[model samples]
Target: MTRWTQAAVLARMRQEIEASAPDPGDRLPTERALAAAIGCSRQTLRAALARLEAEGEIWRRHGQGTFRGRAPLGHPVRETVRLQAATPEQLMQARLLIEPAIAAEAARRASRSDAQYLLRLVEDGRVATSRGGAEEADARFHRGVAEVAANPILIGLLDHLADARRRAAWQREWDRTYRRIGVGEFVGLHSDQHQSVVTGIAEGNADVAEQAMRAHLLTIATAMRRGSDPADPGL
Candidate 1:
């Protein structure tokens, strides 16, 4: 079989394996059985199996055969929360909850270099926004927050959330809203909030840091709600 056809067959097999049992430790069908099922020669099947093993999706035991591999660690959510599926509304809600707290923690724990990193993020955001580089700036800002938090768990969670939020659907919706509604001003406001939180932390004012963080998040939530439903008039 051609290389492309072998790759396609491998992908299909992988999808089937995933759909059948997503959990790790599940046994995969034998190579001969899979080859027969897919109507592919053993050579093509072996090539596909090698690829899957290299990708860490499966492991072959010299004596026993191939088994499913462990899934990569992912963000943990103990309960259902707003925006878990990465809709625009959900992404904003997640940011409102996580980013401010990250800022507050940074303010309480950040070293001088941490503070400088944040300032640099703000500066980058300004330049990027001006140069129509909002997406890159946005990512940098969030990554800076994760760095400042200095907690591996929080960093991992934020990284996963950021990844999900960057999906095409969410980006399209976010860009549409920003373009249609002149919402880019929030970029500067976000920078200011970050600075305020960093200042509070650098000054060793834990109370100020916490309060500023909470207020900043609430403001984001309120703004998102208002923008989502401008006709509410109550906003």
Candidate 2:
């Protein structure tokens, strides 16, 4: 098999092992069995198994055979149940509290690649918004901010918040109502705020980045509370 094929086979094996967790120190299917199952040579299967063992997703015992290992633990939940089920207002409040600190950290710690990634996300958001694809752009923009923050703990917390935001049925209804009302100016304002935050980060101005992020989130909250269509200029 080609090197690429070997890599693909290895990934498949890892996926299978992950899917069937808690193997409880039992020996995995024999190398010959895995080779037959995956249509690869025994040598290829062994290489893949070796990689998995090195990665600690699987382990081998002396003469016992390979077994699935434990997965890494994830961070503990940060927000309360009430916060997790936040309304638009509550989401905005949480955003205001969380994102400013995130921006400040980004200013302090962002590497060149991180800033470039964020810029790319902003550019993509601009394109998506122009094409009337606001949701995708909005998600990308928020995720980009989390990336720039460069803290796994913060990223996990933000991810949970984003997940909650996506699951809110009322948010969709509000977007529909605002769009029906013909509000387009808010998008421009939001885009500007995004640019401001980016500029602050690029300049290494922690205070400015923090304040800009806070203001941007607060503007969103105000717009949502007023039932303003983010896309409507007249609003």
Best by lDDT: 2
* Total backbone clashes of candidate 1, pairs 3 or more residues apart or in separate chains: 2
- After superposing candidate 2 on the true structure, give the runs of residues whose Cα lies further than 4 Å from its correct spot: 1-84, 129-132, 180-187, 228-234
Q: What is the per-residue lDDT of model 2 for residues 1-235, given as tens digits with 9 covering 90 to 100?
A: 4444867998878766655433433336667677776777888888888888887777654444556653223323333233323466666677788889999888888777777777776666565534246556767777777778878988877877776565333456356545543324435666678888888888788999999999888766665655645455543
Candidate 1 residues 93-151, lDDT tens each? Answer: 77767776776777677788877777787777665544257556756766776787789
The true-versus-predicted C-alpha distance at residue 229 of model 2, in Å, is 12
Give each model a TM-score. Answer: 0.54, 0.57
| Model 1 CA RMSD to the hidden true structure, in angstroms | 10.2
Worst 10 residues of 2 by lDDT: 71-80
Q: Mark the regions of model 1 whose C-alpha exceeds 4 Å error after superposition.
A: 1-86, 130-132, 180-187, 230-235
